[model samples]
Target: MLDTAQYRMAEGDTLPALLERYASAAKATEEAVAALPDLDVGVPLPRTPWSPPEPEVWSARRVLLHLIRETAQHAGHADLVRETLDGANTTAQR
Candidate 1:
């Protein structure tokens, strides 16, 4: 099996390559979650040493909430970046 150190990429990778890797990882995550049997969102998550410093732990529902919040944050930032690069803006119209 590959060692954990092999996971780190060398400095030569391009932006597009990194973005593709990110997309693939996200897709795999979604597929894994979709495969799980339905359960209550409020079910308590298993405790792990990697728990966040603030909450210390989270319910299964909170995990989804965090994912939604993070995805929205990144998408909003991407919109701003795209607007800066091209003249196009995705602002809402009345």
Candidate 2:
């Protein structure tokens, strides 16, 4: 297994690349959350088909829009968790 120190990237890799990795790892969860109607803040997205088990994950239209929405959710959840644990809230309004 790779050690923690060795897992660190060298120079030239942007920070968002690291964040994107985390987002990618949580892909399924993000997609699931994104499919929820309330998750679409002011955006009237198409109604995604019910993601049934055994094969049908989600429709193509839902899949295409998932990445952006997923990443945003990751960022939001991270912020809240970090702030609460740190004993201080973020100044930036969500």
Candidate 3:
């Protein structure tokens, strides 16, 4: 019953810029998946094929899972980096 898209922030369309694009895409994937109803999880993806040997890219299901896993990884990195700068991992403390 719902669909979603998001803005992409980029540097200048190069390797370093690809970082922002990846982060943008990951964020967009997250938002789109979250907008779906539970029943939508196994349904076909809207923009891309859900099964692929064609592009060798992840499927929608895999994208969703990766978003979750990578969110945790990025959060951990943020926490660790923050700690290195100021001595804290706030989520761990709270």
Q: Highest lDDT: give the candidate number.
A: 1
lDDT at residue 85 of model 1 (Cα atoms): 95
TM-score for each model: 0.55, 0.34, 0.41
Q: Candidate 1 at residue 61, lDDT?
A: 56
Regions of model 3 farther than 4 Å from truth: 1-31, 34-54, 91-94
Clashing pairs in 3: none
lDDT of 2 at 33: 62
List candidate 1 segments past 4 Å from native.
Answer: 1-10, 39-55, 92-94
What would the per-residue lDDT of candidate 1 be over residues 22-73, giving only the tens digit for each residue?
Answer: 8998898688568657533344444445544544444555767787899999
In terms of TM-score, how similar is model 1 to the real structure? 0.55
TM-score of 3: 0.41
Whole-model lDDT per candidate: 0.70, 0.63, 0.63
Best by TM-score: 1
Determine the backbone clash count of candidate 3: 0
